[model samples]
Target: MNGEVLVGILGGVGPAAGLVLHQEILRNTLNDGTDQGHLDVVHISRSSDMAARPAYLAQLEAGETTADDDHNAIENPAYGMARSLSMLVLAAEARSARLIVGVPCNTFHASPIWDTFAALVAAEHADHVTLLHMLDEAVAMIGRLAPHATTIGVMSTTGSRRARIFHDRLEPAGYTVVQVPDHVQDALNDSIYNTEWGIKSTSPSIHPRAVQNFQSYAKLLAHMGAQVAILGCTEIPLALTGSEIYGMLLVDPMVALARAMVRSAAPAKLVPLDIKLPRDVHLGKPKRTLSVRSDSVDLTDACETLR
Candidate 1:
């Protein structure tokens, strides 16, 4: 597996998240005085039909619909996720990449699909593909950046709202997960998934209503004495430019994951390790077998040098 580390992005869970991740990677590695890109990346932007899942689930949960009522919506996500993950594996094998990362923070798909995807990759590739889970990164950042923060609010899509992985991971870390009210959640979901971020649209247009909804969510979190608020959905940071709205720290998981991914890609050194089985792997988890080092080059400096 001696080759350039190509990063395969399983994107289009929401287009904005994929774009943001690409932008962050470009920002981090545009200049290294290398003719080739600092990191080789392969991205698949297939639109995962997450919008239909919530509506179908809502009906099923309400007993208004049977399990067989919306099998297409129910089954589509797993297929999409598996397809995306499979594509990552193929790309990794083609590039002989050492790292493979996915940016979808939706707990619904992530919980069920991750292990299956890992197994598929492991069975086929074995010890070559590494999965980077983003939720763990969010939990770790909250602990490090705002350790004493008691109440934390999340602004994300309906999928993330239903999954609650962020909440599950954060609660044990001593933070109260304040969910936006149903109406507020609907507004946020509609603003993102129902619009351009949805299956039909392509252009990255910012929804003013969504931005206002997030702003209102931020205010509500601040009112609830939340020391920090997380933009749980990937599209959120694209909507809300810059942090600190109404004096609350808006933590963008995509940006956090981006920073973490950069660290993961730039290792101190590569070492040979016998990875035999599937295990829970989180980004930034130290591997005693490998010594990794990264030279912190300023983005501005990198850009200038590249130009």
Candidate 2:
């Protein structure tokens, strides 16, 4: 563990979501081990129940915390997610983690969740625990990867769409967002909740049908003039890794967030040149920089690919 920094993952909102983010963080932490050894990460694989909309609403509407209330069972989505976040930070702190990053993007983009997280973290007053709006990172990526695009495609959870995370974030910045049509949106919902793209699906690999359906939407969005698609939900990108749809680059918020983790937490000596990302991003070691595009993406060619 690096004495100066420790990064924590707030995952398991979906079974695979946190784990995939954990692996990505792990691989980035590989290559040149740090003096402190591998980058330390605390992962709390939360129960899917925590993200259950119906139960969460039932609990929220039931009102006011009681001694009997189990946060894990009855928490509002945001509250439960925030509760997990704080606990992980506490764990990371014990290990001398100077920074903590929440993953799966949904927790950050969801309504009241972001608001609640802000309120909760403020109460803690720990500057070391870090949280960035994934929407903002996605926007920055669009500016670089599809600089001229006036409209971008977005496919995410029903809750995220209702919250308007993409529209609210993008429209204000002078960009138009192309929302998936209802039928396309239904397909998306199944891919995330009912199919292999879903956390409930056990296997890490997305099924061919799910992949094919996802690409169909990509093609549709492209025909609609959306040049880039933002995998707004953290779960979406996990399926699309190494698969670029109709040549449209995907702006994965997790990847951007991971890049942020490297820049903010990794020790200065280990970071090496921005373009020449050192192998051991955490531990103090030197190896050839893996070449990925320098633009906001610091990932290597083998990892962060557009195709």
Candidate 3:
């Protein structure tokens, strides 16, 4: 790539979402006998904490009244989203990136919030910084992939449980949305918030029961006339990676987003950029003494040096 591209991820909506974005970026870049061809990412992982807001919203949607303190403890999705957009604009300006992308598929909060976020980026008027939204890309891709399909089921978080977010955008293109029932919706929320997406889990296995729950839910939607099922939440894809859930074509929003990024960035060679770590190293956390190496060198020599 002639010009450097900086991907601004408003992550931390959940750790799983952030990790998925990173993995997608890595998957897009093709190794071309070079060190760096993958798009540079300036990821802000703190936003994942905003997931609490959605969980709170789910309770309210369920007709349960919550205390102000409980509400206030969670980050306002609107404010968190705005902050994330601002961060992306600032990063683009500072880094002189050619493009900026935000990966928030659960479009709850408010519609005007997205407009405001767009306006903020437009005000910067950075010629090279093209702001991209994952939801729009995903919707468009699904349309092209399943043109004849009528009803599509969406599996997203409680925050984005509203049908308008997907239907408002997809209906005009001649598609209808079918979502999980309220009870099943609650189960999905628990699976993600308590087990996969949340930090409280002691044993975070894939949880076969969760998969069966989702599969059963998908079948129900299919029985209700949904031609395809869209895995709206980022965490759902990780859970349903290899399993074959019958009764509808399964579509993953994250996978759609990745395909869009690759198609959009075509002709720009992608190369793997591996950041070596100790066997037990964890990402984004500090470690003890360490060595850094680029992709262009021989690891054998580096190992000898370390020895």
Candidate 4:
């Protein structure tokens, strides 16, 4: 439980998600109200080099893995992610000798991407690095927050939904998962993929259209009798940064991963489970148009503001 374990945040999976995870880690770490008491964290965001995860998955689904065509030859996004993460592990070994890393992007955690990334990391750096599984962390949080919950709803990108990320994990744990129908899912996809106002493009400043779209999706999940909803997509939380939606509790995987990182590195430093750090609650503007710099926002200060 050495607090000195270097925590690594893999960015570029939507830069906003990594930033939010970093804030959550800092907010959930127990410090003596001093900068020196905080855990050492390294955030690596190499977005430009990484391919779009959804695009890669879609192509893979269409049987496009062979190198016969240049388009099919595009490297898997996981390779870039693993390469960056391996560099972080090397740096961590040089510094603290121990590391725990978290990737904030949900789509990246889908099997098609995550399996390769994990194997590559484990092949070389497994001895020194512990990669926290974001989905498992979220599911564990659901169990803690709602021990008796039966049906779970998931809000994720089209790629993640197609990958059955949440369903694979939750179903085996005795919980039923409810996802949007294909047509409704298309609207959900638009909320995150529409170039003009999608959460990926407009994060830290959600558009009214994005907000309204997610709201309607949450209502649909509620009507489907979901007892709780998992904001499976990292960007979805940016739009719906609340603990509940339409009476069902919402779970943020980024927060869950952050907490797990703290626990893995320094158990004693982990914040109490009951004192949940509100996710991205510091947006200064009204809900209709949330515009604020996430980098400058402190979750502790935001928690006080909420209180």
Candidate 5:
């Protein structure tokens, strides 16, 4: 793979997280002056059917883990989660993606949905379209940068907690996971659900409550002597900064996935950018959100010139 390739995103599992992943991918790509567009990005956002994500989580939290039980009144286990994921995989495949990166962390956290994606890939026999595991990338990054970090604060959905997503992966590596208190967890969920930074939320910018919500949790983690907090959920970074948290480090798995993709690219294909960097681009906050649910949402179509 020394040539340019099309990368697809199995996105809109929740619209908010998908936008961040899409933005990070473009922000980190090789930008040359000759080409106005950065890279070949094919985005496939699931239809309204992907709302099963929050529904599945609600079921798990309500103690209905059994397959026969209804998920959040959706009347099925995983609430059509597996089917929705399969559909997205098919859509991504239709776009001829060389590599497919899924944006939602909760979708990957759900073992059934994850397994469905894996099986679909095997069935398609499309080795040209590669799927990268976000969890594996995050854990590997943690080992590399903070091997000695024992206490990691995890901010994710209730579904991920029950599945022991980050804890299961980190514990085997000799790290202890620190959990947020019930009150903070409630506020965390509130920030995501009732505020601007959550899935499909259309707030113009990060809301004050959202910032307060994440700041309070980060401050609490610092009090508990947490070395770093892992933004395990894709929506988590929408509220909390992905890089740092009140002197403590914040590990974003989505960001880890994006960087891994960049690093994995061939040197010849990874051309050097010849653009002047803008100070405002560094100082600005993420104000954009992809609220669309079409088959493909191309952010590059609206990408601005380097200032």
Candidate 6:
């Protein structure tokens, strides 16, 4: 255990979402069918430690928080994330020499929030933890899963979409990005944030309405000729747990992030992409076709294919 590299998760963007990421790490890992064979992982999820990601982004965009207002820790979700990351870093370092961490929240990855959190990590926890970019990993997964796919659809929170998180990344990479119109986005948001049935509110047991809304919105993206759809929000995968929607391949960035963390910590322990996915791991089928061999493909190869 002392010689092992630990996988760290900066969780609590939403508690259930964080647990799903932790589960994905375990699911994607190549274990010896025993608890001991699994990689060491440190998952810290103090939901209260962080402000709501969407609310924070909304505030930033509304000019509720200014560029120079570094003193407002309560309004800035980044400070909370950095603090959680520090705890994660400290915990991971006490157990291993190296730590690879991934934050599961897509909205948190928006520039205003991510840049601030990243700076804090670089200043304090940089030497202790290597944070993986969830969006980049997901984009690369699309490349690996569909090398010829040129149009990518994204389903995320209003904050993430408003922040142009996926747009800023995918458009520059030469892929056409598809998103729902405002009304559709509102329905999409309801599926994840609605108090009565939102995935965030009732995860581990999805409401049928939430699933319908997600599939409905995804079909809209398919109508726009999207060959692939990214479940950009961390809570989204729970609501849409299928490999494809309307012939569009559904790719979860969290899965990519988990696989990447395992690769970085211990490539040999990383499971082959083609391995039978657990019931909830959702990639349509384990035997689906691939441009790269399931046995040979790794995160680096996937990202390179995109380039």
For each candidate in turn, the TM-score is 0.71, 0.73, 0.70, 0.85, 0.72, 0.85
**Model 2: which residue pairs collide?**
6-97, 34-283, 34-284, 35-284
lDDT of 4 by residue, 96-116 (tens): 558889998888888878898
The list of candidate 2 runs beyond 4 A from truth reads: 1-3, 33-37, 48-74, 195-202, 267-307
Report lDDT per candidate: 0.58, 0.60, 0.57, 0.78, 0.59, 0.75
Sorted by lDDT (best first), the order is: 4, 6, 2, 5, 1, 3
Model 1 lDDT tens row, 14-51: 56567767766655554456647466777777774443
Model 1, C-alpha of 235: deviation from truth (Å): 1.8
Off-target runs (Cα >4 Å) in candidate 4 are 1-3, 66-71, 275-307
Higher-ranked by TM-score: 3 or 4: 4
Candidate 2 on 176-287: residue-level lDDT in tens?
7886677558667777778444523624555555555555666666666676677776656545544245556566776666555655666442333233212311111112
Better of 1 and 3 by TM-score: 1
Model 6 agreement with the true structure over 1-307: per-residue lDDT tens digits: 3665878888888777678788888877889889988988888888887888777777667776575455663467788777877777677767666778888888888887888878888888776678888998888777665778889889988888899999988988899998877766887777887899887787666677776677667767777778889888876766666576567788888888888998898888887766443442334322211122112112343233333
State the displacement of the C-alpha of residue 40, model 5, in Å, after optimal TM-score superposition: 1.3
Total backbone clashes of candidate 4, pairs 3 or more residues apart or in separate chains: 0
Inter-residue clash pairs, candidate 6:
243-284
- Candidate 1: which stretches are off by over 4 Å? 33-37, 48-73, 105-110, 122-126, 193-203, 267-307
Off by over 4 Å in 5: 1-4, 34-37, 57-97, 195-204, 267-307
**Regions more than 4 Å wrong, model 3:** 48-78, 85-91, 108-112, 125-128, 195-204, 242-244, 266-307
Task: State, as a TM-score between 0 and 1, how close model 4 is to the true structure.
Answer: 0.85
Which model, 4 or 6, shows the larger lDDT?
4
